[model samples]
Target: MNKIQQFWSDFCIVTHKEGIEYKDAFQFGTSADWLADLVVEGKKTATTSGYMFYEFENEAIPQTGEYYIVLNGLEEPVAVIQIQSVEVIPMNEVTEEFALAEGEGDYQFWWNAHEKFFTELLKEYDKEFSPNMLVVCERFKKVYSK
Candidate 1:
């Protein structure tokens, strides 16, 4: 396989621990929606609750670290744990041809992958408890690199 194809394959392996079936397409919005829906449903029992999305900016990709997702219940903030590393594959790997072939199955794969990624990251970080958190894949692009 070419570099791009190899990278794509590796990325899929990392994202989908169970192994990708070549039909999965990573759906971005669905994961966010899933978290939002969870919060909305949880609020009925917990009373006031909400979630916010934060974006990270830097010349290089960030390493996994603690991020805050402010909640009405807490005076401080709810932590959304992350594991950032340089292994991030470029966005171009998800080309039109690949996406078309993968179809909607990729979104399902991503949703499941995000869940596993966050769960595993939390374990690696040694977080005692799982909070209402959503793990996001931040695709970092360099200004000069093509």
Candidate 2:
């Protein structure tokens, strides 16, 4: 498998999520050296959302709590997500057959799921903000925090 595929496969194994999905959603003009991959396990709380997996070259790793704006093909950011923490598992931690036989749809589903999760968080915390912008802004804040 190619580097991208191998990295993605390793990420999926670490995340323990199925239905590997990918999109070229990194910011345009971003270095091609580091490959960012996101994985969603089963549903998670707003705070947890799902698991996000990223792989970089030369052992470089993103700082914890860093956020990223994931864009779709239209160049529109569909979601703002953050890296809560970083962990390094042995390459052997990932098994073979990481590729899925079927493909999931776009990242929109991820956005929507995170939105719901964040909304629940707001409700629990009693925060104030327009529901519409809350999702975007919250995500943006998380992304820019890095």
Candidate 3:
């Protein structure tokens, strides 16, 4: 089996969730190594992404109670997370507390970083970033890690 499959199998076995048949593994924006490190250290607990990206890719919006395996830049599974909450709101509407949960820095840092990231990502698709654009805000708990 590939590394992600093996990691998922082992995680299920240890967590007593073998009956679950769904597995969604992904890395954080651009890559996953730095974000994975933050997560492993319990510094990062939440993230936000532009809703247009999901619609552009024809992917379903993230929902609460879903579980996902967090992969690193090398594509190795490093952590498992369970979604605790989900909110779809305007990018400019995010609360300071939620931004802080991202563990990147303070509210201003989060705002500046996200604005820039979204702007660049949208550009690649010939789209434009707007402060009023919808963003999927997710809060998750680290359930298991290796």
Candidate 4:
């Protein structure tokens, strides 16, 4: 296993001893480390993506009660987070409350950032961007960080 996988394993053992269970591991953002730090600092409690579930049917949606190992840009496990809730809304319908929960910035800032992100992301599938596209919004709580 790699350092991250090993760290995740060790983390699981530690949490298991504390009666907490973790489900999977993943990283945030594409090329930056900021999001991981935000999560570790308890500043960011939510995230959203336009990656459609039907397009990637094998990937499981973030479900409430599941824990995830958050990895930084270096792929090192930085923290563990327990999913609190999840919802799907159109890109244009994301509420300011949810945007604030992202802890990135104001609603317009959140919208602009996500717009650029999803626009580039859709290119992977040769797809085009749409303001009405569905986005999966997830809220989570920090459980542990290393």
Candidate 5:
């Protein structure tokens, strides 16, 4: 089996969960090494994404209770996580507690970094950034990691 399939097999055996398939598998950010490290260290438990990006890619909104495989920079599976919560709110409406859960520093840091990152991502698609734009905030639990 490939790495991810083997990882999934191992996870099933260890967790004794049946009839559950991962909803998605992906890296946290453009570069996942540092973020993956944070996750492995139990620092990052939440993430945010622009709603427009999801629309741009025609992807469904993340739902709670869904499992996912977290990948690193090398596109190798590193951890398994389950979505604890998902919310769609305006970017300006994000809470300090939620930002802190992201493990990226304080709210100011989260705002500055996310604004910059989303600004660039929107620009690439000829979309404009707005504070009122929708943001998908997802909180997940690191069930297993290496």
Candidate 6:
């Protein structure tokens, strides 16, 4: 197995041995390595993504109480986080409080960055950017780190 595969294998073994339940594995931003570091440091506690992307990718919405293995930019396992809550809201409805939970920067910065990120992603599907686009807002707490 490759290094990434081995990491997950080891993690599964350890978690199972300790009787911890994990639901799935995923990485942070496409190129944002710092965000993963923030998660490891227990700074970033929430994330948001385009709801359509999840549908397009055929991925399940994260559930409360589900444990997720967080990977870094290098696709290396960095930390484990448990989902606390998930809400689906329009992009324009995203609030300052939720932006603060992202731990990237101030509210405006988060808004701008996420808008750009989602805009680009939607382009692949020939979708136009819409201020009212649906987004999945997930709140999580770090449970373990490497």
Clashes of each: 5, 1, 0, 0, 0, 0
| Residue 95 displacement in candidate 5 (angstroms) | 0.6
For each candidate in the order shown, give its overall lDDT on alpha carbons: 0.30, 0.33, 0.90, 0.83, 0.91, 0.85
What global local distance difference test value does model 5 have? 0.91
Candidate 2 lDDT tens digits, 114-137: 456545645644643232331111
Model 2 whole-model lDDT (C-alpha atoms): 0.33
TM-score of each: 0.23, 0.28, 0.95, 0.86, 0.96, 0.87
| Candidate 4 worst ten-residue window by lDDT | 51-60
> How big is the RMSD of model 6?
2.3
Candidate 4 structure quality by residue, lDDT tens digits, 12-128:
777674455567777877744788889989999999977584465667777898888888887778888889998888989989999999988999999988889888978887888
**Candidate 2 Cα misplacement greater than 4 A, ranges:** 1-59, 95-146
lDDT of 1 by residue, 1-146 (tens): 74334544554455452342222112123344443333333321111111112222222323434221312232222212222222222322333333232233354453454345545644654542233442223321111101
1 versus 3: better lDDT goes to: 3
The residue-by-residue lDDT of candidate 5 on 65-144, one tens digit each, is 99999999998998999999999999999999999999989999999999999999999999888999999999999998
By TM-score, rank the candidates, best first.
5, 3, 6, 4, 2, 1
Q: Which runs of model 4 end up more than 4 angstroms from their true locations?
A: 9-21, 51-54
Q: Give the better candidate number (2 or 4) by TM-score.
A: 4
Write the candidate numbers in order of decreasing lDDT.
5, 3, 6, 4, 2, 1
* Residue 14 local lDDT, model 6: 68
Q: After superposition, how far is residue 67 of candidate 6 from its true place, in Å?
A: 1.3
